[model samples]
Target: MGTVEETLKCPVCQDFFTDPVSLSCGHDFCLTCIQAVWETEGSDEVPFFCPECQIFLPSDVTLEINTNLQTKAHALLHQQRSALREHTVVEVTGDPLSLKCQEHRDELKLFCMEEMVPVCCLCVLVGMHKNHKVFQLHEACVDFKTSAADFKERISDKYSRIRVVLDGDERLMMQIIDAEEMYMTEWLEAQRGHMEAQIKEIDSLRASRKSLLQEEIELRFLQQIKAQNLWNPLDLTPIQEVDKDLCDLEKLTTVERLVDDLSVALSQHFPRMWSHLSSPALDSKSAHPKLEISQDRKQVYWRTQPVSEALSPQPYDSQYSVLAQESFTTGRHYWEVIVQEKPYWLVGVTTGPVDKRDALSQSSSSLGVHNTSWCIYHGYGQYLACHDTQEKQLSVGKRVRKLGILANLQKGELSFYNADTMTLLHSFCVQCTEPIYPMLNPCIDASGLNTQPLTMFWIKDHWDWHINTEGAKE
Candidate 1:
C-alpha cells in the first residue's frame, strides 16, 4: 500500500535503489549502496551485518538480483524521468553523484598513498595530508588493482605446490620408519639367537655335571658297602682297611672349579654397572697465574710465596679458577679429584668462552652465576651448588676426601659424588648448549693456613718394582 518511491528507497543511501539485491535475511538493498556500507564498516575478510535485522552476511556473500524490487524501482524512476522531462526549465547543475570533500565542499580528485585516503585540492594545500605522497584517484585505483592481481597469482602458485611438498615429506617419514623397523628386527633376531645358544650350552654343562655327581654318589656308596663288609668286628677298628683310592676328593674339586669358572664367565659377559674412571688433566692455559702445576699437570696448588710477590696488583677475579684439558660435548664422562683435608675447594663444569677477567664483585661474571657454568663449592664446613646466581645448600654427611663428577651431556645431568663412599652428594638438571669443561677452584684459606693441593687421580697403565740390593751389601 506504500508509495513506489518509498518502497524502493535504499536503507544506506536513503534514495531510490539503482540495482536492487536481496540479502539472506529477506531484506532488499541497493547493490552499490550495500557494498559501500560493508566496505566502510568491515574488513575485506570479516562478515558484515544487515542494518535492520542485524543478520550476519559472509565476506564472500553473493549478491543476487531482486527482480521484483528492480521492476518496481524502474517503474518509479521512469515516472520521475517523465516528470523531469516535462519541467526542463531551470539551469543545469553539477552531478549530485560526484564525490566531494565533506569539509571543503570541493571535488575529491587525489588519493594520498601515505595516509591511504582521498583528498581534495584544498585538503592537499592546507589539510593534515600536506606534503604526503599522493597520486590521481584513477591512477591509485589502477595500481592497487595490479598489485591485487599479483598477490592472487602468488597465492595460487603456493596452493598448487603444497600437495607435492606434503607428499614428499610423508614419503620420507615412512621410509625412515620402515628402515628403523628393519634394523630393530634384525638386531632382536641376532640377540635372540645368541641367547638361545647360551641357554643350550648351559643345559649341556648342567647335564654333564649331574652325570658326574651321580657317578660319584654311586662310587661312594660302593666304598661304604665294601668298608662295612671288611670291618674288623673283634677289634672294632675304623674302615681304614678299605682302599684310600675309593675316597676320591677329585670329583668335589672338579665341581668347585666348574662353579668358579661359571661365575667368571657370567661376570665377563655382562656390562659393568658402575661408572668407569677417566683421566682428566688440567689445562695450563686455564690455570690461574699464581697457581703452581705439577709436572704431570694432574695437581694444582696456590703458590707459597710472599704476599707482595704472589698476589697480583689487581684483586682476585676468577684467578682461583682452572679448567681441565678434556672437554665433553656428548655422551657420559666421569672423573675424580682428591681433595683430602682441603680447607676450600670448588669443582664443576663450565662452558667455553667464559669470562676470565677480574669481576669477583659481580655475581654474573663469576663462575656458577650464569647458565654457562655450574659448580659445587666447599668452604667452612658447608657445601653449596651454585648456578645462575642461585646457591643451594647440600646436606652431605662428613667431609669426603675424594670428590667425583659424573656428566651426561645428552641427558643434561651433572652429578656430584663422594668418591670414598661412591654416594651421590647432589645432582643438577641443566640446559646445556655447548661443550663443557671440568673446572676447579683451589681456594686459599682466609688465614692462609691451608695449602693442600688439589690432585686428579690417574690410573697407572703399568707398575714398576725395584729390588733393594743395598741390604745384601751391608
Candidate 2:
C-alpha cells in the first residue's frame, strides 16, 4: 500500500489539497490547481476538459469546494497531530474560509475589482493593492457577474429567434388586411356610381317638368305633360344589397383582445422602445407664421390669422407645419400622435438640416413631397402616404385618430400605424445619412371645423400603460 501522503495528493497539483474539488469524471483536484490548469489550457469560451480523464464539461461549469474531501483531509491532519501531542497547534477562532493574510493575520474581506482577487485592510491601505480598486465581498463578485452575463446572452439569442416568427405573422396579417380593403373599395365605388346616375336622371326630370309648367300657353303645357310620362317611384336602396357586415363589432372586439394579449407577450421588447419614448415637443422655431404651438409644447395647430408678434430670425415659410425638438440619429424608436377627430393633418419624419431656401413651401420643401422626408397625409376625405413627391394612396379600414411612427435606422425602415387598433397603415424604407426629426402638420382650418391641435401620445414611467391608447403597448 502507498503512504498516507500519496493517497491525499491532488491529481493535478501533486500536493495536499487546499480547497479540494471533484469533477463528474470521478477525479479530485485542488480548486486553485484545477482553475489554473483549465484557464491556461482551455477557457470560458470553450468546454473545459478534465486534465486526467480528458472528459468534456460545459464552459459554464462552476468551481466549488468538495466538502467531503475537505472534511477527510482535515480529519487526517487532526489524527496526525494527535499522534504528536508535544507539537499540537490549533486556531479555532479563524474565519470559516480559514483564510488570513500571512503578515497582517486579518481575514480576507474586500475583493479587488481590477486585480480580480480578495484583499485585506492593510493590502488595500498600504501594501501592493494600495492603489487598486475593491468592493466588499457581499456587494459583487466576478464569478457571479460572469455567469449572469453569459446566461443573459443565451436567453437574448433565443428570444431573438422567437421575435422573427412573430414578425412574419405580423406581415401576413397586414397583407390580408390590404387585400380585403381593396375588394371592399371596388364594391363601394360601383355602388356610388350607380347612385350618382340615378340622382342625375331625377334632377333632369324635375328641371324639364318645371320648364313645362312655365310654358305660358296652356295647350303647349298640356301637350308637353302628355309627352313626358312620369315614371314609377325610384328605388333609393342600393342595387346590390350588402350581404356581409361592413362593421363587424364582434371581430373588432376580438382584434382588440388579441392585440392586448400580444402586447403582454411582447412586453420584453418594450423596455427598449420605452427607454426612448419621448413625446417630442413641437419646435416653435420650426413652425410657420400661421401655426401655433401649445405653451406646454405638446400640441400644434393651424391658426386663422398669422402671429402678429415680431418673428424670430428664422424663416416663417412653412405650410402650417413644424418639426419636433428631439432628433434621432440611430437605433429603433417609436412615437405616437393624437389626431382625434381632426379633418386635415400630416405626420411624418424628416432627415437632414432644414432648407432656408424653401422653409415649408408646399411645392418646394414640403414634408413627404421632399426627398429628405416621409409622411402620412389626411385631407379632403383621403388617407395618403407621401415620400419624395410620390404619393401612395392608403386604404385604412377605419378612421385613424391616433398615429404611430416606428423608425428603425439600422434596418432603414419607417412604419406608420393606426394607433387605436395597432394596425399598420404604411411603411417606408430609406437609407439615412444623418439625424431624422418627427414632423407634424395640422393642416389649414376649413370653415372653422378642423381647429383641434395635434397632441402627442407616449409612455411615461410604467409598463402595460399604452395598449389601449395607440399602436403600442407601453
Candidate 3:
C-alpha cells in the first residue's frame, strides 16, 4: 500500500476504521481499536500518548472523527473486502470428515461464539468467523453448561427467599383471621344457651297456669294465680336483641390498609433500584469562575461578571463547564439536560477529577475535545458529536430544547437523544477503564441573546418524564 493508502489504516489495528477518530496531534485511528490499546495497558502512571507518534499527550485528550476521511477509509475497506470475497473458493465438506462445515464441508470442530455455529478451520482462518471469537466445540458446550447451572441456582435461591417471606406473611394473616372468627363463634354460642334457658322457663310457666285454670273451685284458681309471679300480666318483658355487627369492621379495614401499603411499597421498589440512572447533581467545585451554580447544584448559568469567590488551588473548569461529582464505573445509566433556547451548549459525560498536573490547556479542556469524555456540541445551527479533537456533524430535524444521554458501560455505548421526543441524535462506542461523570457547558452568552441556564433534569418515577411546563410558560 502507498503512503496515502497506509494513512487510512489505524496504527493499532493496521486496518480501516469502522469508526474513526483523531487525536489532538491530527493522527487518525479506529476509535474501537485505539480504545482496546489504551484500555488494556491499564497503567495510569505511564503517560497516555499516541501509538504512531509516540508523543506524550494529555491523559484525557479529546477524540472526534473526521467524516470525510472516515468515508474514504470505509470505501477503501469495502473494496478490499469485495476483492477477498472473489478470490476465496467457498467449498463445503471437502474432506467429508465427521464434523464437516455445513457450507464448505471442511472439518468443523471449532465453535464461533459470535455466530453461535460450528465452523471448519478454514472458516476460522479466512471465512466469516476470521475476526470473531471461537473455541473448540466441547469447550463452548462446557462453558455454556456451567453458566446455565450457575444462573439456575441463583434464580432458585432468590425465589426461595421470596417464598419464605410470602409464606410467613400468609400464616400470620390466617392466624389473625381465625382468632377473630373463633371469638365471634364463642360469643354467639353463649347467647344461644341463654335464649334456650329463657324459652324453657316460659314453657314451665304456661303449664302451671293451665293446671290452675283446670281447678274445680274458682277459689283454688284465684289462690294459684295470686301465689305465682307469672300470673301478674305474664310479667311483661322483651327478649334480648341481636348485636348490629357480627365482627369488628375496623380490623378488616386495618388489613386492607396493610395490603394497600404493601402495594405502594412494591411499586416504589423499582425506582429505588435504578435511582442511580438519573442525573447526579452538578459539582460546583468543577464549575468555571464565570458560571453560577444553582443552590441545588442541578443548574449552571454564566454570570455577567465572574464570581469574586475563589474555589481554592484546584484548577477551575477551563471550558465554562461543570462536571458531575459522582464517578460511575458499572451499570446502565441515563440522564437529561434542559438547554431550552440556548444558542450555544455542550452536554455529555466525563471522567473522574484529575489532579492539577494532568489538567489540559483551556482550549483542550472542552468536553469531547479529549478521549476522556464524549459530548454533543451545538453552536448557532450546527450539531456535532465530539471526541478528542475530531467531530462528526450531525443532522437534527428540529431544535432540541432538552437532551437525553444514556451510558451503558457494559455495552460500551453512549447514545444522545432529543429528550422531547426521545429521538436518537448521535451515539458513540467507548471502552475506558476510568470511572465516568456527566458534564455540561452552557457556552458564554452570545451578545445577550443566549443566557438561558443549563439544567440537570430530575427524572421522576421510572423515566416517565411528565415534565411540568409551568416554568416554560412563565
Candidate 4:
C-alpha cells in the first residue's frame, strides 16, 4: 500500500488539497487547482479536456466534492503538523536545527557566493561548484540583504525624480495651451470686426450707386418727355454719356475687384510670415536610379540612360522622384522651386520614412494617397492639387515657372503659390504628426520633351538673400 502522505497528496500541487474534488473521469484534484487549469486553457464557454485522461467535461458540469480524499488529506496534514511541533519543541530547548546537503548527507557549513548556494565540505572538493568562490553562509546572507536594500532605495529615488519631472512638463504644456488659446481668440475677434466694417462700407457704396442710377433714370424720363415733340437726336448724347459713367461705376463695385482687394490686403498683412527660408537639398540616398541629382544637390531631372540596372540598391522604387535632405517638424518655413517650364513634374511635401518596397506600385505609393503627402502635379497643360487620392484641378492661366511653398506646421496649413506672379494656387489644412520633407518628381517623358531640371532656390541670410549655387550647406 502507498504511504498516507503520498495517497492524500494532490497531483496538481503535489500537496494535501484543502477541498478535493473529482472530475467526470473519476480523477480527483484540488477544487482551486482544477478551476485554475480550466481557466488557463481558455475554456470559459467551452468544455475543457482532462489534464491526465484527456476526457472532455461539459461546460455546465457540476463539481462534486471528494469527501473520502479530503478526510485522508486532513489526517495526513494533522500527523505532519504534530511531528513539526515536536521538532520545534526540541529546537526551542537549546538544540540548534542543522542543515544538511541532500547529495552528500553532510552538514552544510560553507556557502558558494558565486552560485549563491550552501554546500558541504565534500561538495566543495568535487561538486559542480568546486571552483566557485566560497563564503560563510551568515556573511553572504547579510551582504545580499544590504545590497537589496540599497537597490530598493535607489529605485525609490528615481521614481520620485520622474514624478517631479512629469509634473513640471504637465504645467508647461498647460501654459502653452492657454497662451495659444488667448492669441487665437483675439485674432479671430479682430478679423470679425474688420469684416463687419467692410460689410457696412459695401452697403453704403451700394446705396450711393442705387441713388445715382435712380437720378439718371428720372433725368432720362424728363429728357424723353421734352424731346417727344421736338424729336432732336442731339439731346440723346448727354443721356448716353451718363449711362457710360454708370456702367463704369458698376464695374468698380464688382465682386472680382473686391476679391482682388482682399488678396492684396492679406498679402500685405502676412508678408514674409515664414521668415525662415528652408533651402532644401536633394537627398541622393532616397533618389531613384533613373533620376539624376545635380552635383550641387539643388536640381534633379530624368536621366537619358534607361534604368535597366540600378547603380546602387535603390532605397525607394519611386523611379522618377527624390526627397529633400532637410525635414520640417515645427514652425513656419518657405521654399521655392524653379521648374522653368517643366511640363511634367511633381512638387510637394511628404511625411517621410516612405517604405522603399511599397513605393514600387504607383496607385498606393503616389504622394497624395492615404494622407502620406500633398503635392502640385503639373502634367502636360494642366495643374492638379492632390491629397488622399483625390485631385483638385487648379485654373492656372499661365505656365508656372517658380513654385513657392509656405508651410506653417503650428497653424496646420500648407500653401502653394505662383512665385513669379505672387498668386495663390492652392492651400491645404492638414494635421501632420510626422516630420515632412520636400519631394520632387521630374517625370520621364517618352518624347524627351520634358527634360528641364527641377531647381531649388537657396536663400542665404535675412539681410542679403542670394541663391547659393551649392545649395544650403546646413
Q: What's the TM-score of every candidate structure?
A: 0.38, 0.38, 0.38, 0.38
Model 1 lDDT per residue over 1-474, tens place: 477578798878888787789888887789998888888887877778797798887767899877677767766676687664542132222233235676788878889998677888888899888888889888999999999999999999997797677577557656665666677667667766766776676677567546544755777766754654634432322222334554444554555575578557755843331335676888777676667788898998877664554544332234476778888888777788898867678878888455434323344245544677888888767888887678899998878789998887779899999987978998999688777888877775343445678898777652211122234336
What lDDT would candidate 1 get against the real structure? 0.71
Per lDDT, the best of the predicted structures is 3
In Å, residue 146's CA in model 2 sits off its true spot by 50
Q: What Cα-based lDDT does every candidate model obtain?
A: 0.71, 0.74, 0.74, 0.72
TM-score: model 2 vs. ground truth = 0.38
Clash-forming residue pairs, model 2 = 318-360, 419-470
RMSD of each: 32.0, 27.9, 21.9, 28.9
Give the residue spans of candidate 2 off by over 4 A: 1-276, 306-318, 352-366, 462-474
The TM-score that candidate 4 achieves is 0.38
Counting only residues 3 or more apart in sequence or on different chains, how many pairs clash (N, Cα, C under 3 Å) in candidate 3? 16
lDDT of 2: 0.74
Candidate 3 per-residue lDDT, tens place, 57-108, comes to 8867777766778768766665678664533222332123434665677767
Candidate 1 residue pairs in clash (backbone atoms < 3 Å): none
* Candidate 4: tens digits of C-alpha lDDT, residues 209-288: 46544755777756654754434442221111123442243432454465567558755754353345667888887776
* Local lDDT at 155 for model 4: 100
Worst 10 residues of 4 by lDDT: 88-97
Better of 1 and 4 by lDDT: 4
> What does the lDDT come to for candidate 3?
0.74
Score candidate 1 by TM-score against the native: 0.38
